[model samples]
Target: MLDDQLKSQLAAYLERVTQPFEMVASLDDGETSAQMRELLTTIQSLRSDKISLRTDGQDARKPSFTLQRVGAGTSLRFAGLPLGHEFTSLVLALLWTGGHPPKVEQDLIEQVRSLDGDFNFEVYMSLTCHNCPDVVQALSLMAVLNPKVKTTVIEGGAFQQEVTEREIMAVPMVYLNGQVFGAGRMELAEIVAKLDTGAARREAAKLSAKEAFDVLIVGGGPAGAAAAVYAARKGIRTGVAAERFGGQVNDTLDIENYISIPRTEGPQFAAALQQHVNAYDVDVMNLQRAKALRPASQSGGLIEVEMDNGAVLKSKTVILSTGARWRNMNVPGEEQYRTKGVAYCPHCDGPLYKGKRVAVIGGGNSGVEAAIDLAGVVAHVTVFEFMPQLKADAVLQKKLASLPNVDVVLNAQTTEVLGDGSKVNALAYKDRATGEEKRVELEGIFVQIGLLPNTDWLMGTVELSKFGEIVIDAKGQTSVPGVFAAGDCTTVPYKQIVIAAGAGATAALSAFDHLIRTSVPQ
Candidate 1:
């Protein structure tokens, strides 16, 4: 069950086990149980005398083994076999329990320490997910730091019943206080904020009393950040409220088409945007989701921006740069296996599947583009489209046709995602015409159907296109006076990062112009 090279790596990692570590399990007569024992034995042999595993010590919750620091109720446990991407999770839990706490934000540590009651965090992961480890490590660290918090890292494959019951479609599905927190790649703070501790509600109440602003930009993605910077440069009272900045770009993996910069990740670029906004006098309020918008008094008066948190801000002018989010297929296994074999941005997760077979779930421009780009890196590429013909531009379709490793399947509806509890290994689709189900075996699935503007809140408040995109004119002015919009959230024709940034600057200039011409001197 173990190899020489892997054993060597495990041995080197265990050298840092400054303190004794133990794995307690209750193994009976079964293949899974027997295999679990063998895997543990192999690991123990590799670590020499530093690590130990006991098969018949105790059974606290069914047939399971608990991992903890020698004697303490470390509150870190593993329910199933820790293999695949979770192998690193097991290693991290051991390392931290042995006394090496990761260097994280002081605020994060405090949040963990300030817990009022016992909290159980369950992070479900697959062996092949690249983004699962971070969630696992984060929750595990939180458990280790706070005695009131315990974390169970479950390998999605090891426990099929729980996966089905929980409707886990994506990996790294976090459960906080026994409720589904979030799925896919998510920051710890994002997950933690979802906890109903009354603190968030209180923060919302506080924001409800915000003062009027010269310019208040909603949506904190690239457009919002750029607008904030430009507005603040004018030395005006500029405020930016967003659920999270960087918008759809946050969902993007690798961003190489941002003009001058050759390459940068989505999160990295977002951080840079935040830093730029911070350099100015902009009032940056993150994690504040806009819930409603309307003119404070008259059609041209200060616009009232109501937040989902119950806080409100009044500004003379507002810029809507809420941006857009990836349109999910909403099929089974799509969410549970995300970052596992299921992926969205080819640019970001493509490198993870080098030399492996993958599938593109749409035949549109983005889907075809992803297939073309991935073909050069992966061993093979398959494109599945529900339509009878590819919707990609003629140029892109021609490019795809020329790729030797790429193949397209028209009129195919993705029926389901097939995986082995840990990672996706195949996709099931039905031929639209024949209604016959077909399955394609591959390592990765990229869904690029299209984008959905994050403008649901603006529903009737502002003029919107039939597709829900905010409509804006050449000067970034929306149908509503004293309001402007930019980036993917608007009908701006394009949705690239550079375009969004430029749009943001334009919207800010317009808002500044509106402020100078209309607002009374302070």
Candidate 2:
């Protein structure tokens, strides 16, 4: 049940919505579906004149839903009740179905209008996933903006066969046609960028036979992009290739510590990176993953970078800036209850659980810091650690201990995420000392373990650290001449955006110097 405050807020939003729409909730008599129906009924009562609700009560499946214009054709689906962080998705969807347009960026609208041919996107998500709605909303708005595009939101748990076929282990798994588009919280610009035509596909295929570039950088994180802009400014033929721009920064929720900018989110910074790089005439080969590296000829020869698509791109010099991904807890319900009550980013989803009980998993600096940060927003914070003692720095530990609403638990191994077959309600763990299973009733959980660098494809090609980080000298040159690596993928100690961007500049200058020394006077 919504509190009076929330009810009043929603009532205000619904007052302006006058278009009639049908919310056809496909249901089973299960608790989850019943709860979903009740939620819809409640919302309907608030705007009974504009929004009508009914249930298809016997599908034997999990909670199923569809919201459509009363008379138009149906293509969008809300496979599960959009609850948890996805509650926003339901409200936004209702607005769209009721003839209210979304607030989209003008440039994004232009890109959507530029898309030609028919395109349909199927986004698989769970009601518990906070990251899922971003993708759904972006695609949903795209469908609304352009008649050439359409989208359907699938609930992963409700559609077992579809999930099995896709081998989905995470939420917000987007599929364009039959192939998986991308996963997690994708940005609106990225969705627009992926509408690659057949011409672009053929062009990428021919990269193997193209002339060599002066500098070719792999990875599109802050480092790779920075290097590309620098190299392009030097008036040399430059190219930047990566699976995605923004790298790990795209997953970060906030950027208060970054210099200059007082505050920013990952997606916003990533978009700025894209805009900055696109400002130059740099040849951006996106959606390409570096598979291996080898010399096209012998020593002092142009290098050939093999990509995942079997395309071999030739370059005089290369920079590696592939970054890292978050380290998952790998526990049950961790994925199932993600965004429902389980989250990895304290900065991204912390405010959503305001005044609610939450837990922070891990005792290292990251965990302790998350606990400290969340203590200010949440009603209470319980810190769980696998080790007997906290491993955080004394300063952070002291700060955490000072919090009145914080509790520290040592030697606790998180075993399961407990939920009511929907959103998370409690978390279960085992106490190492007492051999007792303990359950804590909390509304949210934040996991802050560590990060795993992306460098598996460079195996046997360059010298790598035991932990799989690439080895580089002060000049950013790898074991192979003309090959450079930077950012989290290299031996750079600090792994922050500011540090990576600075490293990129250093690498570009180093590559330019190497080119100047090696090139014969024309």
Quote the positional error of residue 300 for candidate 1 in Å.
Answer: 9.7
lDDT of 1: 0.80
lDDT of 2 by residue, 92-142 (tens): 877877777667657557777678887778888765454666788888777
Candidate 1 residue-wise lDDT, 264-379, digit = tens:
86756887998899898888777788888887555356688888877878888999998888898889988878757787867545655667899998998889989998898889
User: In candidate 1, which residue ranges exceed 4 Å CA deviation?
Assistant: 1-109, 125-141, 152-169, 175-181, 298-300, 328-359, 369-382, 386-406, 411-446, 520-522
Angstrom error at residue 490, model 1:
0.9
Measured by C-alpha RMSD in angstroms, how accurate is candidate 1?
A: 7.3
Q: Cα RMSD (Å) per model?
A: 7.3, 8.6
Q: Candidate 1, residue 396: CA error in Å?
A: 6.9
Separately for all candidates shown, the number of backbone clashes (residues 3 or more apart, or on different chains) is 12, 3
Off by over 4 Å in 2: 1-138, 145-183, 187-210, 296-300, 329-343, 347-359, 372-381, 386-399, 402-405, 411-445
The top-ranked prediction according to TM-score is 1
